[model samples]
Target: MSSSSTFPRARKPKLGYDTDQVEEFLRVARRAFDGTPAPGDPEVSAEKIRLTAFGMQKGGYSTAHVDAALERLEDAFAARERQIAARLHGDEAWLREARTTAQVVSNRLARADGERFERVNPLVLGYSVKEVDRFAERLSRYFSDGWPIGIDDVRTVTFRAQRGGYRESQVDLVLDAVVDVMLAVR
Candidate 1:
């Protein structure tokens, strides 16, 4: 009855209906039929009558087979979604690790160069953080409950930059002076 074509049976086999069930229904139907002969009346027991009608309504499809098919489809889609999500999480984890490694490398570089840190971190390689040693000092300030490093005095640069265009040598002196003062206080 479905668009799905079935192979033509050389001899129509009685596989669709359960023979035992049909026999039981026939035994019950005979008793019911004896009382009345109504037109187009199905004489089977109520349950058997419902079952037979259900069978015809489904065009001979077994409910068990249909349910199994749906379950298998659900399982496959769930597995596929999980696999994709796992791959995405793996990528995200790798990115976070890369960012942490980059920050660590930058801190080492900043310490190697004797650059003094200001309230605002003084090193920015365009968009990328080429140095991040000041982040450590900031963390220390936060964790130490503002004890040694006064929160207000973070911008304590005693000497001002020279007015008439700074030379490389003068800039280095400024940096050294700031570092010396901070280290002396510590």
Candidate 2:
């Protein structure tokens, strides 16, 4: 268990997360992150943080503050994981993996706009073809010319929805892979 001093206390409000529950969860998450052995504690992962749910209550942590903190925590965990993988696999293998993944993204991007990803159902909207294609072009340049880009850049990307656009799931999966590969190499 982490020292109480390290945990940020929640404020009381009409509606907010349950402070005690949130604090306990954070303690477990912190222990996992620090690589401390804790019986029955699940290994912490970025996805876990991303999807974490907190109970609501009258007096609790500020949602915005908690969310921002969680984002930073997730990034730190991802960076640490990347560093460990690179250390274990060696630079050559890491770079090779990155290049191969980049190639996959490039090939997918090279396809015709509407055909790049599977379309959503006729009634439902999908990602905008023009918007995704434009971003894909930038991503291609980043791969070819070593252009500077950040994981946040890819993670925060948004596309307008259109009736017959590319599949959002496919684009998002590729972007997530790109972020992982980039982080591993860096």
Candidate 3:
């Protein structure tokens, strides 16, 4: 069993990631990171870490701490992935792939606001086009003008949901690609 202090508990009456789930996931992550994954274990990757979510429960692990730890774990995995790719494919090939991914992301981000992503019907709830466009502008600046943007900024960004807005899945897929580009070059 993992120690209770592995992560601080959420304040009473507040909910956080379920402690058992978080601990079990961490144990699996540890095994994956150490290159000793057991049979039947789901493959773990940087992308998997980035996408991981846990159910909430009262007195569970603090969400903030768990999120930060996951971010670091993702970074470590990404770094290892980069190193292995460079070793196997040569540094230039690794860089070329990163550049290609960046170009694709940049081209998508370069589209005009409200046109960058597919829109949901007025009756359907989706991300606000204006808000998503605002963030897309920032991403464009990051790629075109070398504007400063942290990975966390991309990771934590949220847009207001509204009727007749950009499709949430499309926006999420683009954001995931952006994170991939960021990770590739880091």
- Candidate 3 regions exceeding 4 Å error are none
lDDT of 1: 0.35
Q: How close is every model to the real structure, measured as TM-score? A: 0.20, 0.74, 0.95
Worst 10-residue lDDT window, candidate 3:
1-10
- Candidate 2 lDDT over 108-177, as tens digits, reads 8778756778888878899998899888878877877877777678867899989878788898888877
The TM-score-based order of candidates, best leading, equals 3, 2, 1
lDDT of 3 at 60: 89
* Higher-TM-score candidate of 1 and 3: 3
**How many residue pairs clash (N, CA or C atoms closer than 3 angstroms) in each of the candidate models, in the order given?**
0, 0, 0
Any runs in candidate 2 off by more than 4 Å, and if so which?
Answer: 1-25, 47-67
lDDT of 3: 0.91
**Predicted structure with the largest TM-score when compared to the true one:** 3
Positional deviation of residue 128's Cα in model 2 after best superposition, in angstroms:
1.6
RMSD values, in order shown = 33.2, 4.0, 1.2
29-128: candidate 3 lDDT, tens digit per residue: 9999899998888888999999899999988899999999999999999999889999999989988988898898889889987899988899999999
Best by lDDT: 3
